[model samples]
Target: MTRDQVLEFVKAHPASFMATVDGGEPRVRAMHTALIEPVGLTFCTGVNKDVHRQLVANPSVELAYWDPKTGVQVRVRGEMEHLDDLDLKKRIVNDVFTFLQPVVEQFGYDVLSLFRLAKGTSIVWRAAQGAAPMEVAEF
Candidate 1:
């Protein structure tokens, strides 16, 4: 798949799982895609959360998105960039993650940390392909 196609597929399947390294062990969690642009895929987490701490210590991450009906899976692997832009944080809180409003109220916007997968390699796999080689794209 092309890079644009891979990005579009991810945008369509925004509900995804993200994996990060905690110490030497691997940790995975369900995460919502905060935003998607030509630049990269963005995500938000609480600054006090373990995920944030892990990302800060080790920026490398991998995200997976799947479409059950289509049996399609896309995986993105790269290092994350911690974003400190207040405007982007406001946009994420006000638009994408309204549920964070209460957290924002309690700890302010800084409580919500933003990270972007600025550069990554994406692989697309289809169930129909079975064990065949997956299509890979770089962003």
Candidate 2:
């Protein structure tokens, strides 16, 4: 699939499994994709989350998604980094909370402590050797 196609698929299927290294073993957790920019896939998580801690230990991660109906699966591997931009954080908060205002308001902004993070140079795969790794971005 082309880059646009892959991105569209990712947008359509927003939830994905984010894998990180923990004690030399792969730990996977479900997460929502906040946004997809030209750089790579952007996501957010609580700073106290296990996945966030694992990412600090090892920036390398893998994201996997599948559609049973379409029989299509995508695996993305890349390096992740915490985005320190306040504007970006604000944007994410505004966008994410728009759909979850009531729930988030009840939970408080403490839930937003974990920031805008991104998986850079995301490589997309269709299947086992079905496609080569495509560079999404650097740094």
Candidate 3:
């Protein structure tokens, strides 16, 4: 798959499983992909969440998007770039994460943290391929 194909696959399946490191131990969590563009895959989390603290301590991460019905998976590995733009945060709260509006009202936008996997290596796999090598792309 090409880079654009990988992005589109991720956009179609935005429910991602993210892996981060905490004190040399691996931690995984379900994360919603807030936005996807030419720039990167964007995500949002609460500032007080362990995921946020782990990302801050160790930016390296791997995100996996899987489709069980078709048995297709896309894995992206890279460093996480923290986004501090208030406008972007506001947009995220208002648009992608509407449930966060109540939280934002109580604690403001600073309570939310944004991250982007701007540069990464992506691997796409399909169950139909069996043991064959996966398709790889970088962006």
Q: What's the count of clashing pairs in each model shown?
A: 0, 0, 0
Model 1: lDDT of residue 139: 71
Candidates by TM-score, descending order: 3, 1, 2
Q: Candidate 2 residues 92-122, lDDT tens each?
A: 7787647645545677545553433344434
What clash count does candidate 1 reach? 0
Report the lDDT tens digits of candidate 3 across residue range 69-130.
99999999999999989999988888889998988998888899999999989988999999
Candidate 1: worst-modelled 10 consecutive residues by lDDT: 1-10
What CA root-mean-square deviation does each model show from the true structure? Answer: 0.9, 4.2, 0.8
lDDT of 1 at 91: 94
The pairs that clash in candidate 1 are: none
All candidates' lDDT scores? Answer: 0.91, 0.67, 0.92
Most lDDT-accurate candidate: 3
Per-residue lDDT of model 1, residues 21-45, tens digit only: 9989999999999998888999998
lDDT of 1 at 73: 94
| TM-score, prediction 3 | 0.97
Off by over 4 Å in 3: none
lDDT ranking, high to low? 3, 1, 2
What's the true lDDT of residue 51 in model 1?
Answer: 94
